[model samples]
Target: MDNVITVRDLRVLDGRKTLVGPVTFELPGGSTTGLCGPSGAGKSTVLRALVDLLPHGLTRDGDVEVQGQAIRYGKGDSALRSTVVLVPQTPVVFGGSILDNALFGLRHLVRASRAEMRDRVEQALREAGLWNEVSGRLDSPAQALSNGQRQRLCLARALALEPAALLLDEPTSALDERSRDTVEESVAALRGNRTVLLVSHDPAQVQRLCDRTVSLEHPETLALSAAAA
Candidate 1:
């Protein structure tokens, strides 16, 4: 299988303080891989580095290749983000109808007519496991959905981009048990069809949703990730 993303000796630094690894790993195409560790291990930070979305005052060193193309640091944030969409732990709902939120950011990345855009959004909604709940009310307010629905909508928004890989940051940690299950169902649905890199502290969730695991430890813990399962 081919790797959608390849990282070598990736690191995140604050001033001279080494925050996160000199870790290396590959995300095989169409595979869901888990990134797990104790708190502050930089699991989320690694995701940011992969797409050049590292926060202000922090810098990264190492090579990141997306489908064999090198991702130059601090360049083309828009393009890189569109290619590998990141859905944060907290769901963000924009001011608009469900349909509008679904099409958010999508309008800039892909070119298509209104009808075509709707078609793509519809497909994404299905892929996110949100179609059955929101299909009839796409015109309704986006904020009206439950928390789980909101997260799935965010997932649909990213899926609409048809990203080469999806970077999910502890997607279910903030939800209630029932909501978590629904989100888990959605992630499970993507197991073999979407290339996903998921970060979660929960070992059981990783076991349930991922094909393999990558372990990240503190700065002193040797900046290399564990072997893929």
Candidate 2:
């Protein structure tokens, strides 16, 4: 299978603290893989590392490739942000109408026509299972929506860009069961055609959403477990 994203001997350090290291994995195109571990197991850090969004004073080593292209760590942020979109555990909503937020990224790019952009936004919202709820209120403030709605809106925003790969950092962690299910269903629907790397703490969610799962551990602990296994 062709890999959409590949990481080799990847290590991230925040100042003097080593967050995660020497990790390697391949995310095949049109497949879903989950990164599961305890809290502070560097799941989120792994996601950030992929998109070249490691926090301040953090440095990364090793290679991260997307769609067969090796990502240059210190390159422009837009290049990384365009190809790989990360939806954080806490969804960030812009101060605008739901429609505006969904159309945010599209407006800057000249690739799609106005009608196409509108259609795409509508389609993304529907695919995210949020169209009907906000269809009549396209002009309403995005902040006014429920937490679940906001998260879905963020998904729609990411989907609007039609990214090749989506990195979700505990995307459903802040939602109720119903909302989580909705998000999961959306993810299930997105598995094929888009490479998905979901960093989640819920083992059940990992099993449900991923074709393969990797249990990240500290270097020493992982070596010990490997010896035991």
Query: Highest lDDT, which number?
Result: 1
Over 41-148, each residue of candidate 1 has an lDDT whose tens digit, in order, gives: 889999888877788999998888999998886656687878999999999999999999999968987778899889989999999999999999999999899999
Task: Assess candidate 2 and give its lDDT.
Answer: 0.81
Give the per-residue lDDT digits (tens) of candidate 2, residues 1-229: 7988888888898776677877888888887778877887788888888887778899998888888888887876675686788888998998988889999877864378889999999988987889999999999999999888888898888888888888888889999998899888888888676778888888788777777766677322111122211
Residue 121 displacement (Å), model 2: 1.1
Model 2's TM-score against the true structure: 0.89
User: Cα lDDT for residue 180, model 2?
Assistant: 91
As a TM-score, model 1 comes out at 0.93
Alpha-carbon lDDT, every model = 0.87, 0.81
